[model samples]
Target chain A: MDFSLTDDQRMMQESLSRTLAEASSLDRVRKFAADPADRGADVWAALTDFGLPGIVIGEEYGGLGLTLLDAALMAEALGRAVTPVPYLGAVLAPLALRLAGSVEQQARWLPKLASGQVTAAVAISEAVAGARDGAGLMASDGKLSGKALFVADGHAADLLIVADTGGVLHLVDGTANGLGREIMTGIDLTRRMAELTFDKVAAEPLTGDAGALARLRDAGWVLLAADTLGACDVMIEKAVAYAKERKQFGRVIGSFQAVKHLCAEMAAELEPCRSLVWYAGYAFDAAPQESSLVAAHAKAHLSEVSRFIARTATEVHGGMGITDLLGLHFWFKRVGLNRQLLGGPERVRALAAQMQGLTG
Target chain B: MDLRLSPDMEAFRDQVRGFLGQHKDRYASGAGAERPREAAMEWQALLIDNGYAARTIPKAYGGYGAEPDILKSRIIAEEFTAAGAPRGFANQGISMLVPTLLEVGSEEQKIRWISPTLRGETVWCQGYSEPGAGSDLANLQTKGVEDGEDFLISGQKIWTSTAAQADMIFCLVRTEPQAPKHDGISYILFPMTTPGIEVRPLKTMTGSAEFNEVFFTDVRVPQSAVVGGRGRGWFVANATLKHERGMLGDPNATEARFAALIDLMKSETVDGQRLIDNPVMADRLMQLQARVMTMKFNGLRTLTASITGEAAGLAGMVVKLQGCELNHQIAALAIDALGELGVLYEDGPHLRAKGGWQRNYMFDLGLIIGGGTAQIQKNIISERGLGMPREPKLAVA
Candidate 1:
């Protein structure tokens, strides 16, 4: 028995890592983050050329028909580069549709979603914090009447799949009547978030069973966890690199055991995340029974570990770590945001406990 | 990649399971650590008879000579570990000496030592750490002066665990005192009963006399006693360290410890509420649980690389450092969860989980320090694992 990635998967990983390393490096990410309207169009175009958005879409829908794990790899690279792209909303929203959308809905939307012709945003949170069990938006007669706060890439979407108070989904067009958006300024400017208000906006209802919303939530957790994994990877790598080059008291910082131990401790905490996110993503596709528990585990554990790594990584950079010049804060802020995105450690572990039957 | 074993491997697993199912009750009475040498050897012989002992040894050496299939080996480890049957002697013989011998021993040495060691006829211990040379092992002062057809060795080795039980000690002695430190050391072997040898048992901080200070007052061994060539002790010792690293933290055993933790949380109560029901406790447990799974997958990745003949490189070092830390954390977490009972030892009936948590906490300290200290591990990782610049050596004068 082997748990290593397939050759194809490894090739995909290497190619994406190389491209992001080249095109969406932190310098480029800073350039994009400075432009309020910029969502890394050049890097997005490169990824579109690589057909990343469609990696998990069905073959019949003009996509690669790979698994959620394949898409999670892209998420990791994007997170590592801190690239400004609406991957979860634009790429993964299609999978949500494919999971719960009607046959005609799939026939019409899947190809367009896979081809990058249409972009979608996911509106799953209502408060500054996340909505519980996908229950927040209220819907009646194919019209969404409540708010979906913190909508990812909400302002740029051509379509939006909205989760409501009953943990059901409602699909709305971007140009639909009576819909308004107040763009929110988040610490992580690379990825955009907005407060979307649906004033009886016209939307089409999808098949929104409890199982469907749970899968969407699980997918959300896995994607965010994968992104955090990526952030931790780069933060540790960058910190270690800085330790070797930066000097203090006539010795390189790494020569000091304190700095060396800090770097080593970061590795110890972050290395486990590689496999945690991997198996979580794998469970999303191949082992459905293991998906939720592992996803919760990944999210909760990485939420805390990535935060520690982020703070320690910044500390490794010393005083310059907090400044905008070195751009180390990009990774630090990315991890900070990802730590609280869907559910932080406390919330996620509560869900995990319920799943394990440890709590009533 | 798929985690399903092939049918052949599956059948092999079943064979091991069925065999253990039949004989599990015999010799399962003794804890593996407490099993006497003869009883342990008898169990080892039974397992050897069933083609499980010396799993990687060649069939020419009365072993099954199984191919280097990682899963089958894991299966043997899992079953033998579960059935309470001793896998190998609780000493340095199986894990360290056997592997190093296969790599560099003479064919005669193999014939004379390999089978008997596998059959548990000989118990081996290591004599590497001395009182003054614990972490800086290369600075050992043990000397071996060449005599007529023999080397007269005079040295004292400290903290030699299992020395009382070991039939032979695989040790290092400085053969050329005037040469550079690492260059003068040589790996040698001799029986514990040799003249001028003395073993004084020392109780460890954990309150066990599991270690000793072994002194040799001009003990003699023939020139052929060196395992590898003379003045190659450091290199051979590193080889043994590799095997020790691989064997130190078995992830499956960590998984079992976690399971026991969950069981304790399920049964134990704090302030009339079950421990698992506490949010802080549950969160901590969940985090450690995730780390355990990651450790398992990392292990699988290592196994896959070995099976597919890829260069695992410093992956072994990564596993060693991370594995020990994980084991240590798991033990520490258990002790923390035990609350008041954490203060007690395993001798008391009132202690939680029979005070296994405290006992394991003591054991994890050895794992962290043995093979190499955590600081030494970081040195290796920074120098070799990450290609960072090595620390500049100070003037030795």
Candidate 2:
């Protein structure tokens, strides 16, 4: 089994690492956050220029058809930059369509998604008053009526792919008459989310089954996990770099065991989160049967680990970490939001348990 | 990029699996010994011999393929454990002595040493930590005076595992005491049967004497016995410790413990429900299970990086640290699974897991302290892995 990234994947990582560091630096993130819509266009254009917008879309649909592993690697870079783009939504919506959408539907949407002609949002979330699982929604008579909370990048999406209680995916125009999209005040300023309330919105049902929908859900989990993994990498890097330079008690604070251990613990914890993310992304593409299992494992485990790393990293920066001056909160908050996105540790563990036949 | 094995590797795994399948007799006795201790040793030998062609020399040896592929190493480990091989080949002779010899020993020494150790014929114990030097091992007071073509050594080494059973001891001694503590040392190998050498077993808190304190009162050895140069023992000893860290407290040990815990929980019931059916217990198991899975992937990632000539990054430093922590948690969870019965050390109806939890809970204490304490691990991770500056030394009063 090859666990190393392919050469192209490495190139994608390096390219994005360089591009994001320059284009979406902390200052850039703050600027983008001021007007998320403007940020969305700029981020989308850069990603499209790098051909990342279509990284996962099939070549036949004027896209790259790269594995989710590659896109997930890019997602990590996005996370590192806290880049304000609807990557999870844009990539996953196309992925859902690829896995479940009809030929006509994919033909219409995949190309635009690849070329940045349109943005998409994934509505796999449940209502605020319901279970975190997407089973809270139901579509009746080709008109969808349910609340999809935490709809990522919902405000910027030209299209929305919403899932129902039966695991059927329904495509709806973002500007549909009955669709109500409310922007969410999320913890991470670097990204955006929304609550989409569907009131008998005209929906085009995708030709997919429960199984396909599960794969799509797992793909989302893997992608989100990759994002957190990226954020974690950045947190430790920032923490270590800060520790080395920040002096106190007549020596660099890194020389102090207390601060040293914090950075060390974070490094050790994140090392595993990375491996989990890679496998989760790879499993989605190469090992479909075990995709959900690894995805659940990655999402749940990274969610827990990334949070620890984030906080410990912030702790490493001392008072400066919690302050807006260092802006380390961008990554810390990004990790916090990623942990709760899709589902948190306990919920994902339950999904993993079902996969293992340990619980019904 | 992928985790699926190639057809060739799969075929190799199938062959290994077949050999393991044939010998399904359990090794570790739970109050009842299923196989002789000799049989268990032989089973380990069989595993080493059986996976010979599949075994790749470690990356340190510049041999990378087939076996050094972490997946292959893991598969071999899986089959060996499935066949009930020992938790690990914790033999200092193989894990530490052989690697050190291969790195710095003379051609004659390697030819004379590595094979016999791998065959379990010549047991060896490390003689690095002395009574005066525990964590700051460089300060060891063990000294060897030059005596034409040999060295007369007189000092004591403590916390030596398997010294009583060892045929030979790989030691560090101060050959040039006037030099700096680190530079004045030498790595030497000598037979445990040498006159004036003594081994006293030290019973640990676990109620077992798996560790020993060894004394060398003017023990003599030929000059050829020194592996690394006389003034370079510190660096050589570091190499052995690196090897030691890689083997001791491996995640595989915890994985085995986890599997055993699950089996016990399956066989056990409380109020007509399986112990694992309890929400609190199940959630804890799931968490441990997730940690174990992450460890597995981390191992693969490290292996993949090693084979690809990429710096393994923090994954290398993570294994032993996380392994000790994970095992402690796993052991704790096992005790939690037993509830009030966990306090029972010996056999009884309420003594779930055949009282293994109590035994493990104590045994695990030594593991976390043995190779390096958790604090020491964190220090290494911080200093080496995170590039943190070393902590200032305290002044001796």
Candidate 3:
């Protein structure tokens, strides 16, 4: 019943906050941007060594088995830094696998994911071309063929969790026969993306049915929401601080009513997003049955708000903000990426409305 | 951080609900009646006698002295409002004036006022707004000159709600006119029945004389009646207004109104379709429902912060403005729900649903203007909440 974070959780927040603050420094992110392959290995190991990927993984799988709140705290830290790590691909992908994969699949992947030895991506989207009235790709006969657009960190991942029209998850090797991966140029360069082509890719079925895959996708959306919430938190702090430090009309610009109002609005927008994300996290932790609705609520709310806060953060920073003089842009891009990632705001909202019986 | 109530609190809620249920029909008629003050007072006394009143009042005073876990009291307040009991009018006296007195008044003041206030012995009305001092309240010209051991007050107050029924008035008077606009003031408590004091009723659009124009002509009150230090009236008024902004706009009123609207929509039909089944009405309801949810969340965040001793400095302004705006929107929405009857204020052949929509629509107009103008709240949001610069004031007259 307690809404307050525990001391352990607070420490987790602080530790993550500090780690990202230093590691995701403007210099660090700039260096990574300059050499994309020089990826955030140090930060990655530090987070994993701290048992981040295993946050929701059961202890039986050599993981911490903490709640999504813990996962959220970790995501918030990543968001604060706009750090370049495939946490969604690294953590959520494996968590999804553990949730929906068969015993044999879990045995093959869970330990590697827990130990940070491998990364994975979930492929669910398909291009809407040559479509019928109710067009969707079928996943019968085990072999897989279809292109999953905007596969996050697809090129870097070791495994791929693919879902088809049957709502079932098919686990396939990243470089399996008939599987193709193409890196795409994206606006938020801090986050990489890939187009995954599966030409009847060799695959192994996971779990008994696709029902678990649906659950996993919803959980993934919540995590994506958690990630965006984290990014928004960072943007608010950055904008507020910038407002205080940057001056206009012979006073600190933060002293101006317009800037103050903007920051306040951002703070307002961020708090609810945080609360919604936490509620989703709590639901995931306590009530698995209601997770989908909460996740939709969180994702829909966070996507719009995080995007707003990011834009406001940049606008509040003025010209200095445009060049990445401060570390603000990193968090800004992270939020922008999150808004479009895992389905845009409109899609998420439509899904949420449907879930609420509003669409029906 | 937990928003959930304890078992004890839940039990307390049930007990309160049961008591309210028992007496619901007895006090159902009045919307804002003035004469039968005793009916309301007697209800307060009953609540106090049964330990159901002043849930947050300190025990040292005549209250149960419960440590204020305000959410519980808020829940109780909501139940009372939902039950349509005018018995909760003493809320301002208990929730606002009493707390102010406790904070700034002497021990003697608390002894003299807090207990009886809960018992509904002393009704209070706020006297901060003046004809020329609506949003710019500090420019108030109500004067209280020092005369021997007392202050001779001569001034006028506008938009004073419930003044006709009030036993006393908490006023913001100009004490040091030569000082700066904000610094030259004092917060005083004066009896409304005293000599040279007048309360002229101002009829509202709702057909009720709920507000007033009060005049004070050399009304002498002892210096002991000042709630806080002289020339500190601005701070005192701000504190009281802060309480109003933070706690006054209970979601209970709107929530009850919304629930009723939904029920009516369900039972009624337009063009042979249930009102709730119509997309236009359903979408509107969904949006309002979303707003209500956000307001609830905002209340929780503010309440949690207050409990943790980190008050949200200007977010209160945002809450107040949102409450008023949403209330007005909901009223309009209700009118749309009422269809043709919305235009009729009386029970006529053309009227429907007892003409409640027209009454509500008119009543909501006063809500935004009375507590603080919506524009003033926006100013607060800009200057204080947003740290925006104050607009240059016109030269003082």
Q: Which order, best to worst by lDDT?
A: 1, 2, 3
Q: lDDT (0-100) at residue A130 of candidate 3?
A: 22
Q: Which stretches of candidate 2 lie over 4 Å from their true place?
A: A36-39, A127-136, B18-75, B85-90, B111-115, B147-150, B222-224, B394-397
Model 3 residue B107 distance off true place after TM-score fit, in angstroms: 5.1
Candidate 3's interface RMSD, please? 4.2
Q: Write the per-residue lDDT of candidate 1 for residues B155-261, one digit (tens) a residue.
A: 89987877887788899999988889988899888999999999998886677777789999999998798888889888888877777777777688788888888
Relative to the true structure, candidate 3 reaches a TM of 0.85
lDDT of 3 by residue, B1-397 (tens): 3446789878888987898888765553222535336666676656655555766677677777676776666667767766766544445666579878877888998888888777766777889899999878899999999999999999999988879888888899998989999999999987889999988999877787778999999999988888789899899878877677655455666677777777777777778887766666765665565455556555665666676777655444567666766777787887887677567877677776677777767776777766776666655665665555564445969
Q: What is the DockQ of candidate 1?
A: 0.64
Q: Any residue pairs clashing in model 1, and if so which?
A: A136-A165, A137-A165
Q: Which whole-number lDDT from 0 to 100 does residue B262 have in model 1?
A: 90
TM-score of chain A of each: 0.95, 0.95, 0.91
| DockQ comparison, 1 vs 2, better candidate | 1
Q: With candidate 1 superimposed using the best TM-score fit, by how many Å does residue B213's alpha carbon deviate from the native?
A: 1.7
DockQ of each: 0.64, 0.62, 0.24
Docking category of candidate 3: acceptable
Query: Would you estimate the TM-scores of all the predictions?
Result: 0.95, 0.92, 0.85
- Is candidate 1 or 2 superior in TM-score? 1
Q: Give the TM-score of candidate 1.
A: 0.95
Docking quality of model 1: it rates as medium
